[model samples]
Target: MYAAVVRSYQESPKFEAIDLPEPSGAHDAVVDVLAAGLHPRVRSQADGSHYASRGELPLVPGIDGVGRLPDGRTVYFAAPDTAFGSMAERTVIDVRLSVPLPEGADPVQIAAAMNPAMSSWVALRRRIAFRPGQSVLVLGATGNSGQMAVRIAKLLGAGRVIGAGRDPERLRALRAIGADETVSLAGDPETAARRVGEAAAEVDVVLDYLWGKPAELAMVPLLKRRSDRSRALTWIQIGSVAGPEAAVPSAALRSANFRLLGSGQGSVTTAGYMAELPALVDAIADGRLSVNAVPVPLADVADVWGTPAGAGQRIVFVPTRGAGA
Candidate 1:
């Protein structure tokens, strides 16, 4: 079958005919992949950078996608960790890991929204003791996941949502989606951070995507215990798009009542993800969630592999050229 093969960690995926993955057990089944997203996790895995990456040679580089089974049931699935994944024309998936989609669900939309939306949905719903009507601040809000976080927070009943990002235009656009307000990470870093700090005083939860300089700057001011320390702040670390290894002030940790947690993978069990995934998929299928899906043929994987998906645009790969339509 035609698949996105990544033989070397340094190079982009090469679309070619490759042997299909064999199901290991009766519980597994083969899926005809309809659409798959070029997620950041897939990129990191292909380049051997993600913590969970196997560095396995001649691997198919996709983490999760939407596919159809023999019974014509459309489903959303994730590849088993450390295995060639969902980027092929057909791949074997553990049926237990696949969530059946609602009838008439858009494959490209689900394929594009699933991974990115799951990041925040699970984080907001399961990771911490999230209460309805809590205030949320989404850092790195320009990205697709971050944008989803803004809406997901509101959907889950956040009292207010503030989006913070480097792009002024994207940040403002977030307001129309779900954010009650937006903060720009543009111009002088310190000034932008101070502005974010001013807004952070009332924020009860922070879904942080960019963890490098922005996190440190956001943390320095946020972690300072104000006159009334009654509001319990939860900082959920979702992704490190900017850079890893943030230099947080020791004083801030010592002085604040904030709880910090890293979500995804090891932090949340597969059972937890599966338990919540159906609801998420249902929401997308019901059109409760909005995603801008840019469907490209899997044949073009080589061309668009490395380019970043712009704000609000998710790159979805359809294995067959006509399926993308």
Candidate 2:
């Protein structure tokens, strides 16, 4: 079968013919991959940078995809056990990692949205002990996960949802999706941080995606402006697309009544994720959650592989269907 073979961490994957692996465990099953998303996790996996890193090279480079069984039942699958991943004509999937999609659900959209969407969904519903009507600030809100955070916070009964990001136009547009206010992170660090701090002062929870300089900027001013001291503020770190290290203020931790924690893989257990998946999928099917996606053919992936999927539209690779067909 043809797959996107990644031989080295420094290189892009090549679409080539490769030997497919047979299932080793009774729970494993092969599925015809219909569509797969080029999520950040997939890229990290390919380069052996993700937390759940699979360094065994000469491997297929996808973490999750929409696939169909021999009986034609469509399912959204994750984490191929063979270490070859989901970017292929066929891949091995553990049955426990697969979820049945809703009728009329767009496979490409589900493929595109699920991973990013899952971060905030699980964080809001499970990672933190959430209370309805609390205020929220979604740091780096222009990203895919950040956008989802704003909407999901509202769906879960947030009173005010503030979105802060580097893009002005995109941040402003977040209002349509339930962001009560938006702050621009485009200026100098101090200025942007001040704006982020101003917006964040009253929020009860923060779903942070960017954690580098931006986080540092926000933290400094946040310490000065914080007002809610009735309860501990929950700051859940979800993504580090901005940068991995933040020169956080010592006073911010010393003075503020807040708890900082990460929300993905290691922090949230497999059982916690599984418990939230059904509700998250239900929200998508019921139209409470929606993903804007464009389908690209697997053959054309070489051209668009490392291209960024901005908040506007995520790209989904259709293995069987031609690009945009």
Candidate 3:
């Protein structure tokens, strides 16, 4: 079975085919690959720069995928924290880690949407105490997680959803995906903040994906303008796409009454996921949540991973040609 194996952690590691990996334990079931989700974190893992790097070579780098077991169970999983990932024709995963897909669902779409959707779901529903009718400002709104955040915020009854990104066209697309307003970060931080302030002053919640000076700067004034001190503005920091180090003034917190929180898959317990997965899956199956997935063959995985696409659109790698549903 062909798999994308990284021989070394160089600036540009070679992704090529290698021998199929065997299942290690009885609890680990081998999945017949169907589709895999490509994220920026996968590239970072390949380059030995990801936060969870084990410094191991010849790693299979993919974080999420949809596949089938020997008994013909269709499943999708958020890849475990290991070098043995989902970027292979056959890969092993613990049975508990895999979620069985609903019957007649699109495999590529499910694979693409799972990671981003889960990130948004976990961040909004679990990490932050998101209340209905609260206004939400989603930073980096054009990206995968940001777009999911926008949709999830709206579905969960956010009063107003504002999406902020660098691109105008992408911002327009965000509006179609449940964003009531879109703000471009092309201008200075003050300018961006003022623009957002004009639209909706004192946002109740902020879901921040891009960290760094710009994100920090843009959020500072917005946080300062919160209507009530004890009303509680929440900022959930999920990713650092812009840059890791952010310069934020401590003085801004006086009036904001904000709760800055970090959210990710690792933060949640296995038992928590068992309870949450059912509701999330039900939402997907019922069409309450939607994902924009671009289906590509597994052979084109490298090309798709090479460039950054729109934030809202997900790239799903389908292993079996002419396979759908």
Candidate 4:
């Protein structure tokens, strides 16, 4: 089997031929790798920027993938904590972690969609109690998860959806997807905050992906406008694309009457994940939710990593020819 292995932290991944081993656990099933999503986290892992403080090395870094099982069943999975080995011809995953793919579903699309969709799903459903007709503000709207968040919020019946991002062109694309309004995240924090507040005078929910000084400043003013004293405004933090640390004013919480929630795959229980999987698939199949993906050969993975094409949409890595659509 040919696998891309990160020999060390902070080093570029190398593609090398390796021997394939059988599954060790009874719960594990070997999957013929069809497509793997190249995400920012994968690059972070390779470059020693993310989860690097933990010091795990010699890792095969990929969190989401779609593949076929020995029984010829197509499946996709959200394998976060476990060792990610999806950048190869074949890999093994726990059966509980795998979800059967719909018939005729594009492997590349499924591979690309699962991670971002799950992130959005988990954030909206588990982290925050998002109710129908509630207004939502999505930060980092051009990002894969951010775009998915906008779509998910609309699908879940958000009364108004506002998208904020630095790119003007991407913001236009965001409106086409689901966002009712788009705001450019330019200028200083105060100026950006004013623009966001003006776009939507009041918002019930905030899906924050960028956590930094700017994000903090922007959120402070927007959150301050929530009027429903009984219903707490939910602010779900899912990503740190801007920076890990944020400078938030403690006083803002007092005025907003908001509940700050942190969400990720880690926050979801196995039972909870199982319960939502069916509805998620139904939404996808019904065309209520859109999944955007870019398919690229595994050989070009390094090049894509070197460039910037791997940033916005889900970049699916097709390990074998004829596997992806």
Note each model's CA RMSD in angstroms: 2.2, 2.4, 3.1, 2.9
Q: With candidate 1 superimposed using the best TM-score fit, by how many Å does residue 217's alpha carbon deviate from the native?
A: 1.5
Lowest summed lDDT across 10 adjacent residues in model 1 is found at: 222-231
List, residue by residue over 139-233, the lDDT tens digit for candidate 2: 98998778888889999999999999888788888999999999988868889989887777878888999998888778768757766554577
| Candidate with the larger TM-score of 2 and 4 | 2
- Candidate 2: where is the Cα deviation over 4 Å? 321-325
Write the residue-wise lDDT of candidate 4 on 50-169 in tens digits.
753345656677876888889999877655464456887788788787788777777787676666777778777877677899998898888878888899988888989999988778
Decide which is better by lDDT, 2 or 4: 2
Instruction: Tell me the TM-score of each prediction against the true structure.
Output: 0.96, 0.94, 0.90, 0.91
Runs of candidate 3 exceeding 4 Å displacement: 11-17, 310-312, 320-325
State the lDDT of candidate 3 residue by residue for 1-325, as single tens digits: 6667777777443345566666777778878888887767777888898777889877888877878899999987767667788877778888887778888977777776666777778777777677888898888887777888888889888989999888777788887878888888877767876676555456788788898876677656675555665777777888898898786678666656767777765687776665577677667766777677787776665566667666567776667532222
Which lDDT tens digits does candidate 1 get at residues 1-325? Answer: 7888998888999988887766788888899999999888888888999988776798898999988888988889987774678998998888889999888889999999998999999998889878898889999998889999998998999999999998878887897898888888988877878888888767888999998888888786765524455557788898998888888787666677777889988999999999999999988999889699999989999999878777688899998833333
- lDDT rank order: 1, 2, 3, 4
Name every residue pair that clashes in candidate 2: none
Q: After superposition, which runs of candidate 1 have C-alpha atoms over 4 Å from their true positions?
A: 225-227, 321-325
- Indicate the residue-level lDDT of 123 in model 1: 94
**Higher TM-score: candidate 1 or 3?**
1
TM-score of model 2 (CA atoms)? 0.94
Deviation from native of the Cα of residue 231 in model 4, angstroms: 4.3
Candidate 4 segments whose C-alpha is farther than 4 A from its true place: 52-54, 227-231, 310-312, 321-325
Each prediction's Cα lDDT score?
Answer: 0.86, 0.82, 0.75, 0.75
